[model samples]
Target: MESYGFIDCKDPKYVDTVKAIERELLFDGLLFRYKNNDDFGEPKSSFTVCTFWYINSLFKIGEETKAKNLFDQLLSNSNHMGLFSEDLDFKTKKC
Candidate 1:
């Protein structure tokens, strides 16, 4: 959406995409990159970048309050150095 400049526009497709992402990837307010099992095993963590994208998507879709709340929650899960890893544990939120 950002690459195509669709983030600033209130497009129904963007809204639908956000809704679909929320329904399929969102877990406990965090966003997972995928649900399928890879060669290693089923994914057990949420991708930090994907969650960040979700935050932006929420704000772009007129869900500012939700976006802000989720942003704060994400921040709170960060490490003592105020850094997030590529992935966060889904249940415990450990990096």
Candidate 2:
């Protein structure tokens, strides 16, 4: 599914609904699961997908510097092979 721009979470037709959901996810810091009643609850740091989305969002909102910083942080999370895996440990700084 398309996660970027006005299709899934940012649809204009559902602007209010989208914004509300985004607000909850972005500000309220909620982590949702793929299936119903399967929440992992709050997390200390952002997830891989969310971090990528944040970098994209920063670029989309014209915050290039911030986006670059975020990009660097995300890059630093990569393993020695320069690849990201399904299980990444941001704390230990390993993948």
TM-score of each: 0.92, 0.52
Error of 2 at 77 (Å): 1.4
Worst 10 residues of 2 by lDDT: 27-36
Clashes of 2: 0
lDDT of 1 by residue, 1-95 (tens): 55587464477877898999999999997888999999979999999999999998899788999999999999999999999999999889988
The window of 10 residues in a row where model 1 has the poorest summed lDDT is 1-10
Stretches > 4 Å off in candidate 2: 1-46
Which candidate number maximizes lDDT?
Answer: 1
Expressed as tens digits, the lDDT of each residue in 1-95 for candidate 2 is: 23534365343444454344355544222222221333554443334566566556556545579679757867877787888754344355444
Q: Candidate 1 — which residues are off by over 4 angstroms?
A: 6-8
Enumerate residue pairs that collide in model 1. Answer: none
Q: Model 1 Cα displacement at 94 (Å)?
A: 1.1
Clashes of each: 0, 0
Model 1 gets an lDDT of: 0.90
